[model samples]
Target: MEIYALYGPSGTGKSTSALALAHKYNINAIIDDGLLIYQGKKVAGQSAKYEKTTVQAVKRAIFFWEEHADAVKEAINHYPIERLLVLGTSRKMIHRIQGALALPEIHHYINIEEIRSSAEIKAALFDRGTQGRHVIPIPRIQVEQDFIHRLIAKVDKIFSPKKEEIGETTIVHPQFQTGKIHVSELAMKKIAIQSCEHLPFIESFRKVKVDITNTPVVEVDASFIIHLGQNVNDLANTIQQHIYDAFLEFMDLEVEQIRIVVSHIQIESPAHA
Candidate 1:
């Protein structure tokens, strides 16, 4: 197998840039953060981000567990992996992964600095340090199905140099991120209430419930008293979006579902009143 390694410090955008580099080299598979991603889908191995602690996360990344290493190796053998791209924080880390999986030595090494500018690296680091954002080079659904992390957004389209869409990437806040705040459901309800009030058509919320049972994946149930005039469908969608944006902005938690029900409709528009 022809193996290539992309090495960089944590939060330097290695994972973010993995697809572009893979496209450049026509690499069909990528080993990132202890996950085996093939053709933009996670086929095998667990993500290190799923680990509860940083130490455990690092161990997972380096395939410290025997079962983890065996699973990834078995997947590699099953697939026609002629060329592979492995992402790590250093060449030694790449070597560690190679040793764990019993893969061939890296034929090429690409540093994150080569593909990204210094300014870009700084911005990535800032996002990681402040917002605790991590990028996984796979579709959002892939992460959502297997991971229990705060999903920020899914970049559906990643264009290559030829303007051809390469693949999807998901942004997430892992459980082990430092300085992760704990916001009460009441605070989330307040945000949802404020979101409803911002809409001119929404008079009041009859009920606002924030379900945090799933932790990062929250569900919001909001019943609003809306004014009559505008289309109710448009109004409901606007309320949902507003509340979703509010949670993402104020609390940094992505509300998975924002259920909006028009409990009552006022006779006149708020503007007319």
Candidate 2:
């Protein structure tokens, strides 16, 4: 079987990028944290994130137990997995998993830095360290089947750059993680409106809405009154990009869509002739 390995330090977003990478490379299966995810479903094995401690999680991730390795290996064989992706913290860890499953040599190695920018990696690490949020590259339903007790949230479906639907990711706060924080819709709404501050063309906001139902992925709708004679298309695009960048920089949230509406044009009153 053709194998690919993606490695980075823990919490650098390997799992978050897994489905997209797999879709990009046409890899049909992923071995992530002791779970065998095939075509966006968990076909076999337990999630290492379900463990009670970081040490146990590490052991599970590496397939320390013979039974765990056997189950995943059998599942791999059952499927026509022409190519597979394995995620780990480093090359050594990937090799351990490869040896445990007796899988073929890794034909390609991808670094998380290649898939994500430095700023993105920093944001991911902040989320892991401060928010205790970890991503699993499977649907929320799959994660719920095994770990319903822990708080779970769904991210909006991931899409490739060409707009192909890759898959969904579930946020799992591991048992070992502690503390919980919440960001309300009001805060997000304010951020969306505030993103327009630097643009002189924007006169005032008519309406602002933020959707946090999707957890880490947010949707913002903003309607604004703008100065007349400004390029509406350019202004809308600028607002979209500004808000999208703000969410990432300030909240570490991904904006799935930012809908910009030019509600009314504020034309200056003409002096009496």
Which candidate has the top score in lDDT? 2
Cα lDDT of model 1 by residue, 1-273, tens digit: 999999999998899889998899999999999999998899999988877799999999999999999999999999999899999999999999999999987899999999987645755665576668788899987888877656554454677999999998888878888674455668767888877676666666667777643223333344445556557788778877887787667755566666766767656667866
At residue 90, give the lDDT of candidate 2: 96
Number of clashes found in candidate 2: 0
Give the clashing pairs for model 2. none
What lDDT is reached at residue 15 by model 2?
91
Tell me the lDDT of model 1 at 46: 90
Encode model 2's per-residue lDDT on 1-273: one tens digit a residue: 899999999988899889989998999999999999999999999999999998999999999999999999899889999999999999999999999999988999999999887656766775676678889899988788889668885565899999988799999888977786666668877788787676766766767777544334434343445544556788788888888888877877666657776666655433411
Displacement of the residue 33 alpha carbon in candidate 2, Å: 0.6
What's the TM for model 1? Answer: 0.65
Best by TM-score: 2
TM-score list, all predictions: 0.65, 0.69
| Model 2 TM-score on a 0 to 1 scale | 0.69
lDDT scores for all predictions?
0.81, 0.82
Residue-level lDDT for 78 in candidate 1: 100
